[model samples]
Target: MLEAIRERYIFNKCQVIILDDDGIITLSDDHLFEVPNAQPIENVHPFFETIRHLFDDKNEEHVFHCIHLEIGDVIGNYNVIFNSGNKEQNPFLVLYDFTENCNYIQTIVQRRNESVIALEFEQIQAQRLQAEQVFKNKLIATISHDLRTPLTSIAGFAELLQKQQGTPQGANYVQLISQSATVIKDILDNLLGLAKLEAGVAETQLKKLHLPELTDYLEAIYAPKMQQKGLQFSLKKSAPKNAFIADTTRILQVIINLVDNAVKFTEKGSIQVFLSVLAEAATEPILQITVIDTGIGFPQEATEKIGSFQRFHSTDVEGSGLGLSIVQGVVKHLQGKLDIQSAPDKGTTVWVEIPIQYAAETATAVQTNSDASITLAPLKIIVADDNDVNILLFQQMLAEQENVQVIAVNDGNTVLDELQKQPVDAVFLDVHMDGLDGITTAKLIKSNKLTKHIPLVAFTATNSAEELDMLQKAGMSLTLGKPFTQQQLLQVLQQISATK
Candidate 1:
């Protein structure tokens, strides 16, 4: 019977031992207990003595229950059940290993604790990020609003100075002031654009663009600067004249940024811009643009720094170090590639390739009567703006026009009252104003039968798509961004007048 019990327990990895009535161990499965050679249970295991005492009172059944034992560094959880049948046979002890179950439960608890901690950490980081984004957006809004009014005045007055007759030196000084103001405005615009792009609010609006007209505009704008710097500038176009379907504004921005960099670095060398169609396939037309400048070239190491807000030139040159970054972002948004090649003394060449989408029907350019050719009719216009500087700037710009009366209002309520009192041809509404906002005033004007036909043009510092859409829905006929040039203002006036 003892041999049978020992063999059965040994096969199942359970420790079994038989002890006589005198508390002496008679038999033990040392292998099951992890003992080296065959030894008695009382000699190897420390808990043997304590377990033997439980069978002293053999009158009833004795069960020692669960016991925890440590052998060297290993821990075990064991259950001891004693069998003393009728006092005729020696008592037997059975130890069932519960170590694996205990370890498994412990591992599950540890993993759960780690998961809970990680979840809490992620929640904290999310809340912190949201707060930071809110703060950044507010700062951008405040800066844009505060800087636009002064910038408008500076550029507006400088333009007026350019039109007047003066000495060559005086005219040159005026031109410099105007160019400097424009550069500042461009920097601010780029910063705002970057912010919008980061916030996922800006998008590309593609339209049909005439390449010839674009080249002409660039030549007209930059040729004078090149001449002033004693440098030659040229724009070349290849065959297979094509019109590109693209975001005209962003494309223009990219080209302008590249040209500006070239002009700033070049003193005596020439700058050449080439625009052409690389492949003439109807389905996938590719446009290649290259701007090559023989200027102060940068080291090869600088090529790696062609990303966000990085500059590779001296601090003496005035710039925000954001032009190339903005260009790269715009190119990526348009699904294009940009390549730069240069050496220390040699010039730099920037090549850009973009896919061209051709419209199904070739677009015809809009033809408007020249400003000098258009006969003016006596008209009354309202210029509603809260800022005194903006109002003065608008009045000065309009003073040169013939047979047009401009009335200024500081608030939205006055705008409504002025229209009701007098006959108005058009309303130039500023979107940000006290008492009532521009959108609300426009809605009111459109609702009234008397003034419903009058055209409403929104003047705002922000040209965001959402803002423009809102203005359009509120019955605005046109939208103009702030710090606009004199030519832009005149063009808008002419368009509205022709429609009227």
Candidate 2:
């Protein structure tokens, strides 16, 4: 009976032993047991005498005992039990060998523990890396902020001093100061640009534009800056040229950055920018712009992250490390490609390409023959603004203009009072006001039939096409975004007063 039950219960490689009530061995097949062998059932035979007497007094005689052992190669794990038969045949002892089964459980437990440890280790490493990246970013941000503030003050003070004062030394100092400002601007731009590229906002603007016109404008802006740096800059077109199309602004920014970097990094070197037509007879046309510079080239290792953020020259060539990152993003956004070839002491070349279609130039010129600039009697222009700096910048900008006088006010009610007392030619109103907000003031001014003819130019910082269009439909004759150049201000102001 014991053997049948043990055989059914012990599925793994195991054996069992059985014994009769007199401490006699009845069956033996405990070879699978791995524990140290003892004095057999004979050693426990004496202890049974003490408990058997108590069982007999209660009309229940102890018949047999069984011992389970985990032996052999497996370590010590065992159990023992005693049984007494009532109406059945004499009781017997049974032993179950559980060493092999115990071994399997231990193996599984160890493997589970190992897997858990590995997972925990991976999690810890990932967390450490993430923390380090954040710390590095914050550190860079702090460095950028600290560097730009003093630079801004230096640039502004130098500019102001140069415009008002004169001396041979002062003129030299002014040129040096302007050079310093450019360097600072480059650093700030790189830092902020890298930050933006890392933030994943660079390649998102998928705007398209004509390549030739865009290049012409950028070349014009940077050509003077490059000349100041003692570098010759030129642009070229490849054979089979066509109208170029792609992510217009981003691509332009990339090429511009590459050219700027080349100028800043090279001394007495020529920087040539050319568009390459790389269309296979069977594939889509690809446009490649290669920026070639005859400068001290880059190290093999350093060239890989040329367009990455916060990276700059090892020397004091001052850069914020964002130009390359922005370039990379632009290339990615255009669904094009970027490649670099450089070696120490040799010139470097960066090749960028984008898949695009081109448009041919039309022969007709812009038809507004009414001389783009027409002079008008500077009327009494009422200026509404919440910012004192803006008011000052605007007032200073218009101070030297012909026949112009500006009346500045801070509040909406003040605007009305000033307007009612004086006959004004136009209202230069700020859309963001403390009271009688811009829209409300504009609506009130429009409602009064007497003031309806006064053209209102909204001075806002949002020149987004949508915002400008909306404000125009809402009775704003002109929208001039903030931080505009002197020329832009003059143009908008002229347009408003042109009709009057």
Candidate 3:
């Protein structure tokens, strides 16, 4: 076979050594090899070097580097050691000049490095995204939970007054109800602002708004807040002022957000609003408005963390830390520049600059249609979860539903027991657990004759397709992932109750 291969490629050469049963060279072609001086093969090296077979150990494969006849400078190399075992009789040693293809080794090494870097980069990217997702979820969770208390109280008071009317204290109760509703409305407004900004729905409505009028209007609006907090507010402008064309409402909102932040951070110090003309280029004119406060400056360590969701005053303030992100968003939508200046224990100064085009302002009222409906009917909801926070959140969200009541319990074990104890309208069950998790719980709930009629809504953390399929197989009525909104809960509950 080797002779045929050599014959086929006439440029190649071959040398073969055949061994006898006792490990002695029986015969060899010895082709193409130059004998420096004719002598026995054993004279050039040890007997093993010219031996018929290489290894004698029992169970392991062995290979070794062996020297072959040196060729010219180009083809000088060693053997690529391989063994076909002693099971066959005609074993021969084959030689190749690996120096001719050294690039293969370098390619292997390069590929190894590339693979490692790819893996590391993948892990880093995944961790970064995971961190972002976790941040988003935690923000939603904190906001949802925080907003629940006040909103529930407002809704409950409203419902109580609505139901138990016609008493002497009705007017006082009505006043209290109005106050609670107002607080809720304020919170809702802030939250809606943040959502709109983050979701990119907050767009610039360009119209001509009188700059002086808008600033005065701001003073009138925040006068009470400033007075209530005992903080002084002053407004000033550069001598040469230029009126601007932009979104009036959005600009007002941005100013209010900044002022509100100032008020929140500054307890007893003064806050000031200043407006100045930045520049006037051929294409556009620029205006700068700054909100300066002397309350409490951001810590040096947390200075950069501002305008992000994880930041809050003392980490204990009543905010979701989304205030500055919204501020940034509002500025971006208006083609403005936002910069912050602060010092520890001093105060914060936020500057917003807007560039307006040559066109004058056009203010047109856009009609908004809001449905006025009071959901006063009580709903019976089953709250299932192992976490106290989640269960409490669900209870609080359902607290204001007019005829609605929540049955809170941990785990699915008592679901059957609770079903037997009361006739609930709907069930909100969490998915992750031990010993009868959501799938098992759902299967048990759906299989039972009496409980099957109740809608089983899954509350989960993982939003994977396989997880959803598994939940679907268990016959759940709906899937509501964790950190869901209060209105979402109400909507889901209403949906099931409406269908029934």
Candidate 4:
């Protein structure tokens, strides 16, 4: 039965190789890892240089899972298994292709994700039943677990590759891979954000926001894309003398989505973003963000359906229109207003207005003597994460900083033991772990006299208000969400150092 299945399903999708005790490939089937045609296959290709290290141990069998191998024009996703049982027997390597299986699984997941999103939209429009809410929560959890974790590994490796010295073509390939991973990460974030919004579990974190700095950051991000497309992009700021208190993350999302939409649709013309404060309103001052784009516009009839998971020109555009929906949701939650105007072949203009109050206290500048430089004290940080990939990513991100050392531990208990031995500046704990979860560990650390002074930062993917409250109550000084960038980590560290 097994033989029949193999012949039917895996006929030409398998590759084989036989190696001597010294890990030299003597025989090859020329499917996945191909042997040279004219050469004796001893070590002809540069690709084999790194791969030969896998067989250095001639006594033990090795298994590598889901390796995407490219040789010449042939590319295959394979699971490689090497058997080097006894010294007397030659080692055999088997490569099994699983590309079709992966595609099938991806198709199924895509269909399921679409269905769940549709159901979530319906729930948001109607009364949100408890069962449906629970189902949505489970979907969110599954997405975070199944997608974001693996994406982190991919992104981490891509970042590492970017730091390595390689040929121009190799560097370009790594850059492309990094960009693709970022796009995937953005899609996942949007899906997760939409799900959380529909479930009414999204948390709003309001803080002081510097408008000028925000616009500068957004322009830096989209300017290159605009240049690449041969489109003119300009950012205009009106007189807003003071910073305002707002949900920084949501506001960033709103503007980014609007600008991203403008960039995506406009091909030959210009896109402009304006930030100004309108004080003539009846109630209070309002912050207005307007985006103007010269692109294909929609009909007046479709204006009302813009925020209901609606898409215009579905065939011409590749988008789910979730960005606009997210923007609308955030505005409504903030008790703000959204206005959109467009005409076919003319242009599109979107205005987002949110009520605001100028900050009570303005930031004061500090002057330091340039000739007398300040020196930072030596610091040690303990990072506790159950996932090895996360720990490695953290270490790599912090590796270049001077006067700082990072010690990695897999669990909370190990963290406590490490703290007992040496003093550290800060401890970053992953909220979920195999044993002694972050909250409990944090409480224990805070309650102890010796370690209570050390700052404890929580790294979590859960953005619910309840989770944030729990972390705060458990004595967490701060919480950073998952899929965070190196700059964010550095900023957190800087803040901790300043506080200390």
1-500 per-residue lDDT for model 1 (tens digits): 98888667654557777766665567767434654333444565678765555666774455554467776565677766776534577766777777677678779989999999999999999987986676456555544654665677667657666676586756775766776677677778887876775576778776666688889999999999999999999999773655557777788888898888888777778999998766556467766789999988776656555532242222112332455666777776677888888675688898887776775564434444465744446668999999999999888987878777999999889999998799888999999888799999999999999999999999998867888889999999797789887677777777777876
Model 4 segments beyond 4 Å from truth?
A: 1-218, 234-237, 240-249, 281-283, 299-301, 307-318, 342-347, 358-376, 416-426, 444-454, 478-480, 485-500
Cα lDDT listed for each candidate: 0.75, 0.65, 0.66, 0.75
Rank by lDDT (best first): 4, 1, 3, 2
Model 2: number of backbone collisions = 12
Q: Which lDDT tens digits does candidate 3 get at residues 1-500?
A: 98777665642444454443344455555443433233343433353354424445322333444344443223334453333346654433444444444557658979999999999999999998987677677677766765677777667776777867887566667776656666555555666666666666654667664667777788787787889999998977662344456676777777877887788788887999997665555556676789999977765555555434232332333352445656677777676877777886788888888775544434333334334343544567777788898887787876667588788878788777888888887887888865567778889988899888888899975444567778888988698866676666666766786777
Structure candidate 3, residue pairs in collision: 208-361, 208-362, 377-403, 378-403, 378-404, 379-403, 379-404
Better of 1 and 2 by TM-score: 1
Clashing pairs in 1: none
Per residue, candidate 4 scores C-alpha lDDT tens digits across 1-500 of 99888766775688887776566677787655566543423364444355566555667777777666666677766777877647687877788988777668779999999999999999876765765566456555544554665577567667667667587755775766666677667767876787687677777766676677788898889899999999999998775565566776788888988888787777789999998876553556677899999987766666555533342222223342456667777777677888888787888898888876655554323232244333445678999999999999899987787877999999999999999999999999999988999999999999999999999999998767787899999999788789888777877777787876
Writing each residue's lDDT as its tens digit, candidate 2 over 303-339 gives 6654442233322223524455567765765677777
What is the overall TM-score of model 1 with all chains considered together?
A: 0.62
Pick by TM-score: which candidate is best? 1
Sorted by TM-score (best first), the order is 1, 4, 2, 3
Worst 10 residues of 4 by lDDT: 311-320
User: Which runs in model 3 stand beyond 4 Å of their true positions?
Assistant: 1-103, 152-202, 237-243, 277-283, 305-320, 361-500
